[model samples]
Target: MRLQDKVAIVTGAGSGMGRSIALRYAKEGAKLVVADLNLAAAQTVVDEIRDAGGEAIAIEVDVSDRVRAQSMVDAAAHAFGKLDVLVNSAGVGNIIPFLDTTEEDWDFVFDINCKGVLWCSQAAARRMIEQGRGGKIINLASQAGRRGEALVLAYCASKACVISMTQSMALALAPYQINVNAIAPGVVDTPFWDRVDAQFATLLGLERGEPKRRAVAAIPLGRIEQPEDVTGAAVFLASSDSDYMTQQTLNVDGGNWPG
Candidate 1:
């Protein structure tokens, strides 16, 4: 019960890493705001938490929309009295060559991955500051952020921005005792990767799972990662365990990236 009585909002809680983190937080005794673009999906996660005897609520939000982002914070605060932790996990990506990348593609990815984090963190930090008790903001970066890839230019850049923004946010919010950190996960076996694998397959002229197979083989740990593999770090960042830590990006990448 490391997070007993804490209030947390997990964006993209409808699926993948975000859903896993939300469920874990609820089990650790935190009241959760399972925010996602898909209201139905978020409600499903909320239902699971309730069935497990944990407290949670679901909200639909487009994090890139400043108004919706602010309303999300307001809803969380209104639900549980205050904000304690915010996990910016809503994101999108596409596989395209550098030259083939269009502005629409870039904006589609950046809107959710970059601008979304900014708006949500801004709203959350404002509420946390008003609460006068410090808070935690955990972002989901990617090993792709550590290096450029031929087929994922926009996504890579967006995640790299997340890492940079994490550092800047840690500095900006340190005066309020808020800790900001990020997790850079490697190739996790999530539904998101299913889309990525398909895109890679079409682009590289390989089989449906070949790109992912190669990625897993390259991991020194000898396995593909899972959403659960990242939960421990997420929990640490969201709880008192990381009170003295900030501006750091922990690599949950199984030695995929040397950072």
Candidate 2:
């Protein structure tokens, strides 16, 4: 087990990529702190991990809240005696055109996507620094960040901020042996798309699911990525295998948004 006896904190662990990453970490022998906005959802993940013979605890948290984010770190330290990894996976997506994107919309996106990362990373870095051992911070970025999406202006901007923050954090924490990096995932098959399909249908006056199908066909991979597709890269980054890696954004987009 690459992460044997390690302590990991995964935000947004209620579902989707966050839930998958939490499960993956637990399978590798890491004791998990699964935090999410929904208490029940987090509990479900905790139950799943326990059923698999892994140690985990679920906490309800809103990453956008600094107090709640710090409390999450405090809880993890209390349970596992230390914090080794912090994965910022909580985020929101928006698909409104740039002109129509209200200030409220932009604020919501940035608060949950970028500010949430800031709060969690800050809280986790404090613990890691106190422990005097290196740590890992993996943030969830997006292909939309690399190539701006017109309809998802706020979301793209927020993820772009995440990528930049990863670089800045890596440089600042290098002396402390803490590595900060990000993963820019492309289209993944999740309930997110179902919501997007419905929203886009209403926005465009088109039949439901039409935009989704078109988006899928546009991807070179010919299919949306599954949550599992992201776990392998995450495991590598969180493990000793990536000791020399930092300040990087690894894209797991099935060839989408190629440079």
Q: Candidate 1's C-alpha lDDT? A: 0.96
Candidate No. with top lDDT: 1
- Model 2, 1-259: lDDT tens digits are 9999989999999989999999999999999999999999999999999999999999999999999999999999999899999999998886899899999999999999999999999999999999998999999999988967777889889988999999999999999999998998887877776787788888889899898888878888888889888999899889999999999999998888776
TM-score between model 1 and native: 0.99
Model 2 regions more than 4 Å off: none
lDDT minimum window of 10 residues, candidate 1: 143-152
Off by over 4 Å in 1: none
- In model 1, the Cα lDDT at residue 43 comes to 100
Q: How close is candidate 2 to the true structure, as a TM-score?
A: 0.98
